[model samples]
Target chain A: MSDAAAGPLATVTLRVDAAEIDAFAETLGMPASPVPPTFPIRFLFHPEIRAALAMFLPADGSLPIHVGQRFRYHRPLTAGETLTCAVSATPPGGARPFALVRLDVSDGTGAAVCQAESEIAIAAPGFTWDKLK
Target chain B: MNPPRPGEKLAAVPIGPLDGAAIERYARASGDDNPVHLDPAAAGAIGLPDRIAHGMLVMGRLSRLALGWRSDAVLEAFECRFTRPVPAGAALTGDGRVAKVDALADGHRVILRLLARDADGAIAAMGEATLRLPG
Candidate 1:
């Protein structure tokens, strides 16, 4: 489990787009700004993480519900800035299948921007994570 | 909005009428297309009454409030507990206050307490953030 969790599950670079930022702001009923505070989570998404969660997904592939989330930002991320993130997933000890993902984001200049952690709790019972690992 | 005193209550800002459109837009922008957020049928299949909005969406409102405190400030730490599920289309509000204030060598560390409440006025999520502002 440790070995599987040690290596990064994915890496993706994204140029923050004004439109995407606008879309996010629209959801919160806020007018467009440089960037929304939670916008950094965009870089954390990847196929591998999706596939991992798919192992325990409900028939419709909805989710493991998001239980908690946290972030530490070095600076405010703004629109049009390019950033990359390396993501790692770790399942904490428990019978219930739940996991935490950490995304370490860096700007185009390679300076650290922020670290976002998301905790997801799965309601899947009787599924063996050993198969996925 | 009081003078940043500990335990001072800030005016509540109405957050979401978090509908399907908003949920889908957030999913697309954040790249988190967990079907439960987009597909009501899928959500019901899993026993949810309907597609649930993302927990981070609630917390994001708090983040916005914290950043609005000072344009020059940075969020040094932010942590939140998802107390309950916020359904899509719920009229939610963002509420928070100053929890503590400390003088650091480089800046003033203001601790903030945050809450997002669903329409029933029950707390859906709660947490605290520490923001560092210039001295």
Candidate 2:
């Protein structure tokens, strides 16, 4: 995808790997479920996507900080399905000076796999601002 | 807070001490290599005392609690915000409780309150989740 006027937009496709799913559960010390609810995050914000995010950072050298996240699912994504993710990074909102990165993951068949919204702090290192507790 | 019941405490998630190695493992596992979660120098440059665990890493603990609920229940939604920076290497505790339950067209909608705290007792992350259970 080309760069949008507002920010950078990138897309990538990946297959749902069962090993990856079980690893996520094992890492968290939980028994893997028949379906993973939040596994899409790994692929949606995978390393390359993170690089895409860095490109949109403020020219002042401020790095992005993840402040919050929300996940919605039509149904749990299972194995045997390939996913395509469209990630768009938007400049910080007016009231809050934080970037809102939206990621929409869909099955190859165009079905919604999961929708995730990430709130990132776009402040550069050493920048001063009221910190939230 | 008068008394607690056995059936009430559904899950006890043991968030192992989040250290650099562990954080790196999580970064590798979650595919989130945000420098802040892996580099203490970078985290310090940003005013954080040290490298901090990803908010999702802390939030994921709630899944254990969600799963401990009725087997028929399906986790429909989960939402939360980062309240404070949970420095890597701190022992974290996760607790979940049923806040409310309502009837839905397909099943019962169960709302569960989720909270994770550092060893110091400060809330690291908190949120609510909805589960649809066929009755």
Candidate 3:
């Protein structure tokens, strides 16, 4: 994809290994469910995924977030579950670039494990109030 | 007011200098194939020098800190807003405090206020979580 204004958007994918999932379940002290454990466990095993997304997306340097932006997650993973997470921007009202993301977890046999969606926004690095005005 | 839970305090948790393979591994796990995360050139187009981490991935880190305090507590709700970007190969630290703890007749629950930071001490993400603890 080119850096041009019209270049194709970027999307990142991350995988959750089974071994790591088990370790996470063990850490949380819950019997491994047919799904992957939520939150903290997702962090340790799939941190690289987080790093990759942050490299490009912009953020608020301080506190107080924008109204349209949010985050979300799904439940546990059964052994051998493959999750596909994606983040991108959409045209809100066909003008402003609105951040949107989704996660799709599934096993090879055509059954989905978990799915979620949330909004995102890319603030220009060193975002300035003047730019917004 | 009643006394706070045994070991409740706003604190920090440490994380890491993530490698490329790990990033790739997470991408596969989440089923996302965005080039910016997998391709350096794509990231550059977005004003990023190289591939970066996922926001949800950062939230996951924050979640770990929130849940780390108890052995059998189940997360009832996990929510946050990504405040900043966390670059690849950067060290991460997570923090949280007990916002509220309610003891019900059946069991007890706690609301944890959370924050995850990058090596630079930047608040990469912030949020709150509700966990259910049985007696």
Candidate 4:
């Protein structure tokens, strides 16, 4: 049962464009697609991916779902890059769930750039998930 | 007085009034309407109590605070731990203390360790940001 409780990791892959990355980069005052060696590629796309992966997790549809406790990603995401994101739960314990997610962003040549992990939690039941809409 | 050096303490910037519309706009702009960030109903159905703000939005605002320290500052590295949820329409604040200042061939740089707090002073998001300064 403990082994079963340690659910298998979930994996997802996404393709990102320069324009989309640029929009977020603009807020940071950087080019839409950062120049190679300018800034790490993980920073370029991890935020969005983090948010997306957070949503992918089920939380009973409640108002205050807090999933990420800690996140670590090292590498840069380039425009026209495709990232294969993987998430898995570490054995669940004591009122929270701990997991690690890795995002592999690669170019056409299959050269990898960014790898990231997020530590997330979903409060145990007893919250209202029906009123938020 | 000249603004505190990059590594020095800077003023705290408040967060919140987490407008749902703004979040929607960010979703539309980013093309990521993850139910948790966009649909309150979806968030609830999944057990989330309310609509939560996008983590990047909080980071963007905090980065603004860091840039305010120096005109030529360029973000070098930004990392954070999402500590708490920032419910929509609540007031939030940004706090930071400079971690280090570096001298580079192109310019001087400062690293600011920052955190966004709710009105109750609870951390909503915490992270570090590095910026390049004009020599």
Candidate 5:
């Protein structure tokens, strides 16, 4: 994947709801006092973000495999904060077809709070990088 | 508490013989309603034998382990690479070892090498984490 091909694929806004955080923590069997480090992943499921991701998914309804992830926390996230999450993807490369996805999250004031990177494999049977490109 | 020495193995934390119900709860809570994790039929359509667990769920479990390592420790970064899929009813265990420790002005910067393995002893995921432990 060339640097030029790596550009913002989608941007979505999410409000950090304490209730949702609680639910997420509860589901994972963790304490809810502090937001879980991986909670930002929920932003990927935002309707707009999902729409953007659909562009790379297979028409046959096969979901991409999440092969890797990385999270960097700038500071602790607080409840009641509005966050802007920007997602970008590199063109699929490597022996297996996989794309590197990056998510940049900032608070309403635009200060960076966290960043996440994920590697997703789209190499299910009959799927090819050409289809995504 | 004393700072962890390099190469010290952290205790293993058992996660699950995960079932569909747990996966569904995660989907509901995280808003990830991917059919591949929810519907076996959808998973089978794509060649998966059964519904699979969310990779993020495994990461969350590992994060919990890291956080609980020390009350004064704060997580700064976490990274993981999924090596294999965790099918429904498969259990997982997470463990880590202190890889490096550097004394900082306020505390220690600790690097941990982490792994999650399936019941069959196959590595399901492996990664590293960075945490700041107060002196």
Candidate 6:
């Protein structure tokens, strides 16, 4: 993962692996052809993106709870296609201490493929915005 | 197929009694190896009663139910809010209703309000989807 310019926190290249899609399809008991609408969310959990998210997590063992998700597909993603994914996150805030993470995926030709956003609730006592960089 | 009228209910899809192995498969497939969804011990340490299913996995099943409503329609957007965590061994059923429909030059744009209910009929998650049906 490399540092991205102003908007995105980091960027990484992702391939739409057929095997992974098959596994996902089997798990959901769906056909693998059209690529499930929520399939692109897997991109958000890429190791690189996880590493980037680690910074916002509290030192405590408290796990972040996934509270919300949204996906907008510009076109159906196909297996074996390589794409670029850029991820960005908001600082943990609000009375509940939550963060919004956004992911933008683009095809090899720089065309938009999909965009996903997830909301995670961080449950750390006494946590404040000042604690984050 | 005829366009569905507002307030029409779509067929419900029943999902698992999501056992550990099923959650593990989804963990591997999605690369979301978060211990909270995999290891019971890890989940316990974090104050959870047991390992929970991945929220995305639940959303995937709900999206499948919505997609099945119209074969010719393409899902343009989907948004879900995980109101409750689905513990291991929980069974869920996805349901949706046509919220609105708009006629475009080519086809109709449909909006669907969705929900995932636990075995007891408690809401685990709620969502909305927009699909484009070509003429």
Q: Please provide, for model 3 over B31-134, each residue's C-alpha lDDT reduced to its tens digit, 9 standing for 90 to 100.
A: 44556567776665556666776665566556667656676776666677666555677667778788887988867778888877776677766778777777
Fnat per predicted structure, each in turn: 0.64, 0.61, 0.09, 0.15, 0.78, 0.70
**Segments of candidate 2 deviating more than 4 angstroms:** A1-8, A59-61, A127-130, B1-9
**Could you give the DockQ of candidate 6?**
0.48
Give lDDT for model 6: 0.84
Chain B TM-score of every predicted model: 0.89, 0.87, 0.83, 0.84, 0.94, 0.95
Which of the two, 4 or 5, has more lDDT? 5
**lDDT of all the models against the reference?**
0.73, 0.73, 0.53, 0.56, 0.83, 0.84
List ranges where model 1 is wrong by over 4 Å.
A1-6, A46-62, A94-97, A125-133, B1-3, B70-72
Better of 3 and 4 by DockQ: 4
Q: What TM-score, over all chains together, does every model reach?
A: 0.83, 0.87, 0.58, 0.60, 0.91, 0.91
Q: Write the per-residue lDDT of candidate 4 for residues A1-133, one digit (tens) a residue.
A: 0223443345456676566566555433444543322223233235554554454445544233434423222444556666565444443356534443434444456665544444434433464422211
Candidate that scores best on lDDT: 6
Report how far off residue A120 is in candidate 5 (Å).
Answer: 0.7
iRMSD, per candidate, in listed order: 5.5, 1.9, 8.3, 7.1, 4.2, 5.2
With candidate 1 superimposed using the best TM-score fit, by how many Å does residue B92's alpha carbon deviate from the native?
1.4
Per-candidate DockQ vs. reference: 0.43, 0.60, 0.12, 0.15, 0.54, 0.48
Candidate 2 local lDDT, residue A11:
85
Residue B24, model 4, lDDT: 71
For residue A91, give model 1's deviation from the true position in Å: 1.5
Q: Write the per-residue lDDT of candidate 1 for residues B1-135, one digit (tens) a residue.
A: 223568867677777888888788788867888777888886776566788888777777767777676667667889887766677888788888889988888777899898888878888888788887776
Candidate 1: tens digits of C-alpha lDDT, residues A20-102: 77877776656667566677766656565555435433453334777777888888787788888787777655663457778
- Flag regions of model 5 displaced more than 4 Å: A1-4, A94-96, A126-133
DockQ of candidate model 5: 0.54
lDDT of 6 by residue, B1-135 (tens): 877799999899987868898899999898888778988887777566888998888998888878899888889999998887789999999999999999999999999999999989988889999999998
Error of 2 at B18 (Å): 1.5
Query: Rank by lDDT, descending?
Result: 6, 5, 2, 1, 4, 3
Candidate no. 3 TM-score: 0.58
